[model samples]
Target chain A: MELFTLIDILWMIFFLSLMIGCGVLFYRLGRRSESDFFLAGRGLPWWLPAASVYATHTATDTPMWVTGVIYRYGMRGIWYTFFSAWCAISAFVSTRIFRRSLAYTQAEWQSLRFGGLGSELLRGWMAGWQIFMNMFILGWVGMAMGKLCNYAFGWPLWIGLMGFSCACAVYVLAAGYWGVVVADFQQGIIALAVIIITSVWGIIAAGGPGAIVSKLALMGESWRVNPFAFTGIFGGEFPFAWFITMMVISIIGGFGMGTSIDWYVEAQRIQSAKTVRDASYSIWAGTALVLVRNSLWAVAILGFYVMFPNIPSQAEYELGWFRIGFEYLPVGMVGFFFAAVLAIHLSTISTHLNLGAMYATRDIYHHYINPRASERRLVWVGRISTAILLLGSFVYGLMMEEITKWLIFALWIMAAGVWLPNILQVMWWRFNAWGYLSSWIANLGLSWLVVWVLPAFGLIPDLPDYLQFWALMVLGALIYVPVTFLTPPEKMDRLVKYYVMSRPLGWWGPVRKEAEWRGLLHMKGED
Target chain B: MAWIRRHWTPEEADEWQKEDWIAIILSTFSYIALTIGVALSLLMLAVGFIVLILGIGLSVLLFFVIDPKLKAVSSGYEKKQKEYLEGLERVQRWEE
Candidate 1:
């Protein structure tokens, strides 16, 4: 274990105090009302939420995940980290529509978009799933910190997992999203600054970029620098077909809400923006930073590879970015780097803590259990829920190693079969609640069979992940399409009201015509 | 008419048009260019500089084309947000 000097310890104490102080500072504003607590009174400028977005997604595991891919596949591995591009079209399309709807969460959006029992069912299912998903994310990310601490100081995994998360929960429980977002702004700036400094330091340590490039050429590994160095068309490790599938999933997926798992976190940011314009720009700008940061990390990982040359294990190589920071930085600065790592960990933890509580308090408690609840009572419930999620995450974190595979399967099911339906629900007027619900149900069974059961029994060959995505998509459509046609379309009046409010893009022709006919919306020329 | 519509009425902006399409296309291109360009540029490659410049240019064009339309839409929506919020509450209470 590396010894941290007194200066390093003091640095950690100072940053920790500053983060907790944000909770105390924002407590009054958060206590004022449910809106103030969860959404910063929905009055933030674009940059506030933008910073939160950048901070929230830059979790402790992010650099490791990025390092693993870049080290294994060279610069071409950047595509693996490109999934956040779902924000590209979403910034213009779904962000606009959802902002106009003024729904508190995607679960609430379901009720606004569809009517009757199916909408209610969808709302409850989504809220429960989101709450579970956020907790699961908290567990895994916390465990990542646990592992990192174990690597750095020989601390037990649980101590790192439980300690930092509890500290972050201070702000989340006290001031809700108000505390979370404000702290995130400071954390985001620190994380970005340190990331640039350490990465450049790493590049310099490996004899600078010029020497690194020349050395790679000498080693006959020059293709590692080429971003488009595909091994073959469809058969090799890095294939063109895989690239095409990734592009489609990343870009086209943006047309739908909840297409990427990141969308749910971003939905909160979208609603918190002061205007629809602010919301759109926040998502767009925030994701642009994410992409740029990934690229920075990519080059730094290349620097690490050139120096190490032949690391055999995935786990060891994945720690390359951290090693650069911990091993190379000046003595006093090591503490500062550790503080930045805490900032990254806290930013993610605070987001999930507040996010999971939102589902619990707003969608579950207030909507279903106590619609007549006071603002004070609701805020209290939010705090209580935050505490519950934190405690539950500890349990989830401890058991994470045993269940990592199953949870990953759960995440894949969320993305693959439901991806097209997610878009259709936003873009198509006749895509009823039943259709969407059935797709989720169909995908669960289909994903398990295709990914595990069938492969285990040797009924079918185990396919690559991209191929599994296609197979699930096609199989899911067969079930949901018939159910949609078999069931009646959503009520016209409801569709008309939704169209007048949201003005969503795509095959919304019939809804638009009905809205115009009812005089709820005017024709372009008439207006 | 200008190739890109800069000024939009709230009513006109509510409709999806070529401007929105242009913004989407440019935005996607910018993401691709910037991601690839920044990495290579950091390595001091000449081609990286060209791609990075293209990404910046595309981003600027995207913002100009879409910002006015978005502003119009936002102003219109803000006026109605109060009413929509009430509707949201009713749905939550199962009173609609």
Candidate 2:
């Protein structure tokens, strides 16, 4: 383990105190009402939440994963990170519509979109799933921090996992998202600055950009520098087909809500914006920053490859970016780097804590358990829920080691089967809550059969991940589509209200006419 | 009537028009070019600089095309937001 000077320890203490102080600073604002607790009263300008978006995504494991891919596949590996490009279209389309709907969470929006028993069931299920998903994410990311700390300071895994998360929960419990967003703005800047400095420093260490380029060429790995250097159309490790499938998923998926897992987090930022325009710009710009940050890490990983070209293990190379910061940065700056890691960890932890609490408090408690709960009572429920989530995350974090595979299966299976239904709910008026709900159920079972069950029984060869995505989508549609046609459309009154307020796109001709007949819609030339 | 719609009334902006599609296309291209361009540019490649510039250009055009429509939507929607929020609250309470 590297020895740290007194200055290094001081730097860390100072950063920690500053982050915790946000809770004390914003405590009044956070307790004013339920909206304030979860969304800062939904009155924030675009830039504040945009900064939060950037900070929340820059988790401790992000660099490790980015480095892992870049080390393995060179510049082409950046495409893997491009799954976030769903925000590209979402900023203009779903962002605007959802912002108009003014729903605090996607679960809340379901009841607004579809009426009656089906909508109620969908809402309850979504809220429960979100609560579970947030806890799972917190555990997954918290363990990543634990592992990093173990590598750096020789600390035990649980100490690293539980310690920083508990520190973050202080502010989350004190001020909810008020503290989270404010701290995120400060943390986002520090993390971005350090990321830039370390990347450039590493690039310089690898004999500067010019030298690095010449060295790669001499090493006969020039294809590593080319982003478009795919092995072949359908065969190689990095095939053109896989790239095309990813592009289609990333870009087209933006048209629907919840198409990407990040949408749930971005949904909070979307509602927190002051206006439709602000919401649009925030998602677009924040994700643009994310893509740019990935590029910065890609080059730094390239530099790591240059200096240590012969390393064969994926685990070692995955730590390339962190190793650059720890092994290369000057003595005092090592503390600064560690502090930025804290910033990255705390931002994500705080977000999930408050987000999970929001679902539990607003969707479950206030809506179902006690609709008559006062604003003050609701805010308290939010804090209590936040505490519960924090404690649950610790339990999940400890068990994460053994259950990692099953959770991975859960997240991946969720993506493919529900991908189209997610979009269809936004675009098609006839797609009811039953259809959307069925897609989720179908995806869970089908993903198992395709990915593991059939292959294990020798009924079929193991298909590649891209092919699994195709198979799941085709198989899932067969189930949900028939169910949708058999079921009646959403109530006309409910659809019209949603249509007038949110103005969704696609296949809404009859609803549009009905809305017009009811004198709900204003024509294009109307004042 | 111009090549791109730079002006929008709230009602017109409420519709999904060519301007929305144009913004989507430009936004998609900007992300691709920016990702590839920034990485290659860091390695000091000449093509990287060109692509990076193209990405920046597309981003600017996208803002211009979409801003007016978004602003119009926001302005119009803000007027009705209070009423909508009230309705939403009733729904949350099962009173609607």
Name the lDDT value of residue A438 in candidate 1: 100
Chain B only, TM-score of each candidate: 0.95, 0.95
lDDT of 2 by residue, A1-527 (tens): 45577888988999999988966589999999999999898888999889999999999999999999999999899999999999999999999889999999999998899888989899999999999999999999999999999999999999999999999998898888999999999999989999999999999999988888888899999888888899899887999999999998899999999989999999999999999999999999889999999999999989999999978998788899999999999999988999999999999999999999999998999889999889999999999999898889989999999999999998998799999999999999999999998999999999999999999999989988888998999999999999999999988998998999999978888899899888888654556
**lDDT on C-alpha atoms for all candidate structures:** 0.93, 0.92
- lDDT, candidate 1, B7-36, per-residue tens: 888888888999999999999999999999
Q: A525 in model 1: Cα distance from truth in Å?
A: 3.1
TM-score of 2: 0.98
| TM, every model | 0.99, 0.98
RMSD of each: 1.1, 1.2
TM-scores of chain A across the candidates, in order, are 0.99, 0.98
The runs of at least 3 residues in candidate 2 whose Cα sits more than 4 Å from the true structure, single-residue gaps closed, are A523-527
Give the residue spans of candidate 1 off by over 4 A: none
